[model samples]
Target: MRTTVPPQEKLSLNVLPSEVWRWSAASIAQQIRLGSISCVEVLQAFHRRIDVVNPRLNAIVHEDREQSIGAARQLDGLHRQDSHARGILRGVPVTIKLNVDMAGEATTNGVPAYSRRVAPADSAVVTNLRCAEAVINGRTNVPPFSFRWFTEGPLYGRTLNPWSADITSGGSSGGASVSVATGMCAIAHGTDIAGSIRYPAYVNGVVGLRTTSGRIPAYHPTTAQRFYGLQSMSAQGPLARSVEDARLGLLAMLGADTRDSTWVNAILEHEDDAEPVRVALVDEIPNVVVSDEIKKALQQAAASLVEAGYVVERAQPPAIDQCVEIWQSIAMTESRFGMIAAVEETGDASIMRSVHNMAACAPSVDLGGYIKAIALRDELRRKWNEFLRAYPILLMPTSCHMPQPWGADLGTVDEMRELVAIQSPLIAVAALGLPGIHVPTGMSNGLPVGVQLVAESFRELRLLCTASVIEREAEAGSALNYTAS
Candidate 1:
């Protein structure tokens, strides 16, 4: 792994007593274990950061400072008693998305009507973070029902992109990305059904990992049974400022849970020989008008990988359009049966408009059609799996266009159709249950730009290794330059 100071750390170094907020989760954990810092001091630094920045960003919608401080005190006592009591993420301050279950907290999911729907117990992800001794500072915001790409609703208002308020802070993980980018947390937990995790990270200039569907067990104790779309497509993962920190967060969240039947015990890392690996570089889609900036980002990432001992070739996966269609068919139809009524009744205006536009873009499907789409999705997954067998890593654009305007998804149905075409890269990977990571390259025209890397299911280690290489190059001049303003 390459070691270099990230742009965020460079800025933090100039300030007194506030540098702790910018340290990576790995560094924070090690420092706490070595008795260099107490959990109370670490939590205090983040609390100060939240107070200074969160008012403008609106990233962390819910906070429990007293509870977090108490947890930190208990952790400090444990560390004093047993020298080996440190978990992998011990003393690391983190934020959980509001959509997940947290005991005594409302899983409002950005819906005003559900503000009173408190969770009786922690979700599996929260339980894993607590087991890892991570301090949950607060709950981040999301779109209502987490159904839109832009993060804004009646409940939490909006999460501004630290780089530019005019551009979106991509959802449904918008707050997760913003919180991590602005140093409010070392790591932020995010959930991705479509591009929720990856897109938010892309726009906010952070690293987001959309793990394989079953890599991290997920369940919500406060909600009803999950829809089929969410069950097969949604993934729980982490967003952080660096690839190593993201890996640390992932390890802390992985474990077996009886609540989620889809949880897998797959090996986390694959053995590597000394030979160079093949990487398929996908810079353009057949019918998609990929912006020049996006293509340039992909080329730069590919060049970095080639210099790091990987063979890069131009190749496109099979049936990408079909994959998008199948994704929309299954996801939209499932929502129609399971969530439309609730959304119409309780969702905010933004979600109501975006959901209707999305439904209009999807081809109407009956029960048999939905089932057939699910079957076809498996076939597409097999084809992509075969493609990935030859190419261990596939480099592509995170989005075909640059960061969009704040309310881009609330436009006409035809506009949403166009948006979907540009977002095919994100949809295809989610549809196939593959693992992908968004690594920021640098800034372009005052906004962050980045590339996406996809690997075979359960091959996150490969993605992380490759992402670190590109990230080192990004350290030269990346958007981590943005400080909380």
Candidate 2:
């Protein structure tokens, strides 16, 4: 229920740095509830930050400046009425990905033809954020249909990396990652079907959580049909500067909604007192090529986990290669029917070229082949499940190599295939509908590199707890403070 606002007008306040835009969502909410700072002041700080840095990055494309001010004022009024009333994300500025629905806003998904396709109602995640009193300052950009690993489109233009303009900002949630990394917002809402959230978080040097399927209620009112892999494999999650902030955002987003019956009512954390679980570290993925820097990143993360009291074993997850193939088959088959057709009808040359090349990597499956793939998928999920029962968490590289240069994905079919191979760590977890966390360890060759932590479904708490240990040891802010040349 919406809290009643006080009769008092919006309070006049002065913005303060070091405690304003730089604070995490958890800290912002706590400070606002404690009356240490007015909600208006916090909002103004982010508004000023966005004004200064957004033009250079182009991360946040659609902003309702007046609406945001009004919302912040409303939140301040509510706080005045009941200082005790504090949602987990109260007054925290958040940037929503353009692909998700926000009432009366365009769910463009980077297609110019559908720019007028305004959402009549908020998606489940948006409603949850509003209920948690998050101020929606702006919307982040995405690739056409959010399909590419590089964030650029004909509609909103390309989102440049804060570290290097030559490299990608990482899509389809590239804009979301950049927003958090550059202090555009405390937390950014993003989706991950096949590494969209984690990859961007890796490249952008932030913490991203790819919650298990159904962990967060998600539904786009503008979407016409329900595809096979969309709900089962994809998830709405948060990308933030720190693991604690991401955890808070995930807490705010967890719940069941009638609109998305597929959502599970799972507890965020178990009450049992268990020791830190064993971790499987995979530095060298079989048959996939990776740079020495990537290998060092894996070792660094594993070493941190060991120091934090986790039993770090050097082992690979089962069926890594097969799971990647399953992702290709499922995505390719589903795309042929819906996503591919729509892209062909409305997509620009860049997206069309990337999509076509991706298709070349995986042939369209027939009905029988599709059924077999589903059966194979269940078997693979079973393997991971049983394996996870033994090793509760698996730590691996987010990508085999560093972030690709701009327009790398829009290359020859062979190049796309190589890209897919390097991304097996992300693709495999996606296919099994598991939870993965992308935590940046350090940088290599002037770019960020990180590790992916995977856990069983409904075990996000386990992943976060372990990631926090590594985050603290790694001193997470070095990359965030790096100034691009």
Candidate 3:
């Protein structure tokens, strides 16, 4: 299904910090640090925005007005650290994907069954952000079991795209991306096991980062273990409206945590203008039908970057299909062990059964295969590293298809199978554990399009530079089509 984007929202230049929710995270941080706005003021700004837009969009499932306000209230004079005021994100209003934990909040993961079960403490991502003084405005939407590419809860129904209400905001992190896109939060935190971070960013016309695995330490309140494969594929990153916000979000979230053994040595050589980006325009790499609109956008972005003095080549990516299978073996095994256990324990198996049954397709490997998967995963890492020895960046469509409708069919049975196929492009890219950036480039039917930039480990600086160049080109051409309700 296609969607026509409505006109862009009427943003007031007067309130720069609160104007576009996409960059609001960084904007509010600056305001709070400069004392131009108090933490309470910034938090209240976000709260008011939620009240204004969420009912129409349904992007945020649960919100805490009092707690958000209270957090902001404590941010008064945080700039004066000598006076004992504390807040790293002092006054910054942020949203967490419902899949993650926040104290006293339910890690719903978009399921109705767990709505009443509250978390005892924050996830590591949340704790790190809080340590930096960010106020948790609310929990955003997710696909049921946090698996699909569309946000619909048997609990909350649907999360409509803010730019075009009929279309989706993209899933797993759909609600978070939508909330950030439409001024709900400055930035929203999202997880990337597959393409949760990048696809949503593409659909929402924002900046989303999929940091290399082990870069941003991931920890939930409940789990203490992450298997090697899961550790390799499982990484958490940030989604924001702007490149700098993405940079700041990554800086805030990347830290060592006890829960994840893989989270270590984040001493990345951060460089914005990292030489000529050896880029490959991998169009339809795995035979996925690349939409003409997306293809045009990719080609346009590549040409613009080339004109901007970067070396661009239309080459093939590392064996994305093989990488995907390796990733699937690991991901499905972990899913069965974790999600299936939860399903069986509950016995209230509706969506749970569907989730488990789907996971059953790629059951865990034997000890030998497990060892081989690890060996192969490492081989892929080295292969990508070697490829980057030549090319620094890769340009591609974040997804082969455009954004689906709000209540699209990515359900149980056929739905699960379809999503598994549909999500392949993102999963294929993500399986390699590289840093990919989704930069909003153009629009169609009032919705947004993004150019996906894949870079080697620690090449995020180069990716951001490419995005900055693309951003300038896009701005020089046309602004994003932000159709308001």
Candidate 4:
């Protein structure tokens, strides 16, 4: 709860505007490098903003003000010496999700019992961020074990949505999105297995990227066990107010890491610059009921893409519902092996209820069924790969509707199933390990709504480019600039 601004030794006496906190990560780093702004000034501005905004939102659960200031001072020293800092994110203020390891901090994952589980070394993502000289401002919150669509834990309490307190902030990356939305940080590290990053960004009126599996290496040294479903579905990404910043973060976090054997060094951009990007606009899906606001947002995004010269067609990807089913089957099936037992031992009442309800929704299968599910998952990935080959980008609703009220998923087992059904677009694409971006369109009835732009693995550059155009349209329509404090 230390909210005091950093000592203003190298800072300007004139009060900076509230909008200073909203500068994109790229712009912040550029100014810092150009000697126009000191890293200390940028970090202090964010810490001041965090004090003003995070108290109400509870988006940042943990902070190390001294550590952040020291890091910024070091970057300033490098600048004084006429030596550049690290990579593209040098001197940029950023937040890390609490589930990941940052040296000397606990990887709490919102569990009270493991509050003492301090990490001895940085996780792969943290290592990458440090290498890029991205100053860590604070650690964001998550649900216990990150096991729900809403972010509230017995240890950390709840992360309120900046837009509406009644609605969900969207877990397990809820705090990350809220932090970005409120300008707590320029970039937020987020990981998504099923809609964790995208859903929160959708509700918070920000941008979040769920990169393809293995695009960003992730490893928690304290909890480093191999989980099949997690290995296949989970991806490390970034949440920001702009898609360009998200793209910058994704690039900085990429490349192979020995810690994660699955990490790939594949080229991230389009192979052929002259190739035309084909976008599939999916406004409706069979058996999915989307709100009119959601439909309008999708149509608006489609029109934006069309204007941007992307060949937009009204079409749906193959087996949308089947992909969701596979996600539930594999994710729940793999969790049963060990995660369920851990939750039973240490989870709070809310998380325990959610785990049970989610378990009830996707019953555990025998070995034969598990094997078939894996094989079926492979088949679905093949089909999606083929489909994506035809349509390089798919523009669809991020969620079937706006974010639900807090604790909606904790209702009856049937209610949990309904919630999952609505999140089919998020879960399905995750099942196939594709990269998806949540691009916010505008507000609806004081709530945020947006569309999802998905691309084949390693085609994140294309998705970001398409989202930039949609972002331009959204900015033109909305009176309140999201980046403005």
Candidate 5:
């Protein structure tokens, strides 16, 4: 078996303090557990990095440096009292998205009216992270109602892409992606209903995993109820620089909570069979104009998997166009019930325009039509599951085209329809409740480009393993290499 030393293992006692911020979460936790580095030192190193980089990117909108430092001190004391006191992610610095509940902090969701709506308690994901002994260093930004792909809003302003100003940072988890890419934190929490997590990671050149729905329990204490579309499709997952770090974050975040009725306790890993796995490569979609750059990236990823001893073949799954339409029909219909009204009332002009454009594209349906769409989703899932039985993995573009310029989402209804088509890859996976991840291939046109890997529900282990292979073969350099121009 091939092995490599953790990044921290290569550092000497006199190494530059700034370099500590670049270490992976696995490396940081391992070093902290070994007692060679103190939690205070790790937290302070990240604090300095945030101070220097966050002003330019606006990734982390809320921070409490003193509180994080105090927490680190407490963790250090516990580690001194007992050697086994370290959790899997002990002393690792993490950021939570602003839309999720963090006790005593506002679940702003990028609305000015809800700026004072402080959460009475932490959400399930937040509780799990705390239990794992990870330090919550800050909160990331989101679009208004977290409804747009661009991370600018009236509440916290815009989060700039570290690579280019003209390109979007990729929201509604844009802040999360930027924070991880720029070394503000080792791991960041994000949510995905459509392409929020994967899209941001693709554009920013980081790893974002959208776990199976209900894999990680989600609940916000401040909100009374969530629309069915949001409840069924939204997923909580981690964004990190490496697949190993994302796996560690996912493990720590998984736990049963009574608050979420949909939460399930499923086996995370399965024993590997003797036969090699097969990968289904999707380079193009019917009637969709996939960019040459993205198709080339997918072809490169397929080649990497083949080299890694996996069987790779060109194939397309069932009814991708139908999946996209069903997702829009159900989600848009449910949003009209209440979410649209709220957005219009509280959302800023950008989000409002984006939402209006999206609604315009969605097919208006009656209750019976909505129910039929729900039933059709099950049929699609059944077909997809049958397809996966033959090919355990699916490789495709994270988005049909490369990352677009900012304000693309705020374009006309016709433009928004085109944007939705481009995002079909992300939407189909989410709508069917499958596991998907974004792994960067390399740079093109001076911007990051990547491919998406997906597996059946509760098969996140497979996705992560495959992504690790692609990530290793590609060797796409760190997002930190790019200056925030």
Candidate 6:
């Protein structure tokens, strides 16, 4: 419901910070509703922090402060009108990824090519956040087309990790992760094609969740047909400093968003929470090399879960080695048919770079192999389902290494190819269409590393529930460059 409130007017108030920037969305909302803090007050505090730290972080780029304050004021007015029940999100300021549409704002996806193009309507994800009563305060930075784990595009420049400017803030959700890590937003909206959300959260020392393919509806009016694997491999999700915040954000985002036709009504559940469920920890996923430091971080995380009364086992799943091939075919076909065509049509260098990568992979893939790859996808999903039936959560390295330097991983097409190769596990796992969480556990060479947790379809509650166990026990965080005041 639109309100008649003016953008300039606000309920003047101030609230002191309860503690560090580690506040969760649930806790912040509770505090706002309890009148311990006003919506405007909390919103302003975050804004101030962003202004102070974002120069170095470059997490949040474009934002509508007036609109946000106005929304907060409207919520305040509503709360006064009816204090019986607070809204879904009473007073939480959030950052939206630039790749997604927001009404009357440009959805650039960090392309220099479309920097001036503005979206005519809000995306399903954005609409859902508004419905949940979250204040849309800022638009985060994303790589060109939300493609890579390092956040940099000719349009919005670069989004450096708050942990260290030297290392990358994982993309395409890299900006969102940086925003949350630096306290710019309580929760950030992000999308994943391969390891976009998970990578950023892994690098920024935060938590990121990738909803199942249908679990969160993704739509863009620009294209009539979405590439097959790009259609199934991609998802929109939340990035936060804590698992509880991830839970709250995912709950608000899950549902049938009419914008996407494939969305299903898959409700979340917690199966037999009375008895602790099994968790599988995998440090090896075939091709990727898990660094010794990264291995230590995963082991430490596993030990913490064991201490928390959950049965933690060191094991690899059935057919994990074949995942990369299947994933490569699925991803390559989407690019070969879609992205390659777009690049050839435009002949733009940036788009051409994307095409070149696809063309390089095309020759290696067989026509029949692609078809069989599609068939095998079903079997892979089945294996994950059966595995989750026994072990509700699977823990593994979010990536094999700590956050890479901002431009270290993607300078050349070869380098970009290498990144995809290294992160094959994440891409393959995401294709199964299950909910997964990437929780920052430790750092190496002063950069953050994380452990990933995967759960059954629409079973975000279980993923978050299991994640909470490791989050508290392993108090590890990403590398942060704390400036002296």
lDDT of each: 0.86, 0.85, 0.72, 0.83, 0.88, 0.73
Q: In candidate 6, which residue ranges exceed 4 Å CA deviation?
A: 1-22, 341-355, 358-363, 366-368, 411-418, 478-481
Q: Could you give candidate 4's per-residue lDDT for residues 140-226 as a string of tens digits?
A: 999988878899988889999877789999999999988988888989999899989999888888889999898898777887766
lDDT tens digits by residue: candidate 6, 102-212? 887877777655666777787787788888888888999987667666777667677776666677777778888888877888889988877888988887788899988
Q: Name the 10 consecutive residues with the lowest summed lDDT in model 3.
A: 1-10
Q: Give a tens-digit lDDT track for model 1, residues 349-373.
A: 7788889998998989998998899
By TM-score, rank the candidates, best first. Answer: 5, 1, 2, 4, 6, 3
Q: Roughly what TM-score does model 5 have, to 2 decimal places? A: 0.96
Model 4: runs farther than 4 Å from truth? 1-19, 83-85, 271-276, 476-485
lDDT of 4: 0.83
Clashing residue pairs in candidate 5 (N, C-alpha, C atoms within 3 angstroms): none
Model 2 C-alpha lDDT per residue in residues 1-485, reported as the tens digit of each score:
22111112232224334637777776778779879888889899988888778888899999998999899999999999999856778899999999889999889998998889999999999999898899998999999999889999999899998888899999899999999998889999999988999999998889999999989998779877467776788888999988878887887887668888778887776642124778888787766777898888888888888886889998878988888888888888888878888888874889999999998998568989888988899999998999998888898888888998998888899999888888888888888889999998887777788889999998887788888878877844443353333
lDDT of 6: 0.73
Give the candidate number with the greatest TM-score.
5
C-alpha lDDT of candidate 2 relative to the true structure: 0.85
> Tell me, what's the RMSD of every candidate?
3.1, 4.8, 5.8, 5.5, 2.5, 5.6
User: Candidate 1: lDDT of 463?
Assistant: 86
Pairwise lDDT winner, candidates 1 and 3: 1
How many clashes show up per model? 0, 0, 11, 0, 0, 3
Candidate 3, 264: how far from true, in Å?
A: 1.5
Model 6 TM: 0.89
Please give the lDDT score at residue 288 for candidate 1: 85
Question: Which pairs of residues have clashing backbones in candidate 6?
Answer: 149-171, 163-479, 163-480
Name the top lDDT candidate.
5
Q: Give the per-residue lDDT of model 5 (tens digit) for 1-485.
A: 11221122444445534478888888888778878788899999989888888888999999988889999999999999985754789999999999999989899998998989999999999999999999999999999888788999998899999888889999899999999998999999999999899999999999999999989999889987777766788898999999889988898898889998888898887765223499999988855799999988888888888887999998899999899899999999998987789888874688889999999998889999999999999999999999999888999889999898999978899999889899999999989988899999888978888999988899887788888888877856567764544
Model 5: residues >4 Å from true position, as ranges?
A: 1-18, 273-275, 482-485
lDDT tens per residue, model 3, 129-226: 88877888888888776776667757777787766667767777888888887778877899887888888888778888888887877777754476
**Candidate 2, residue 202: CA error in Å?**
0.5
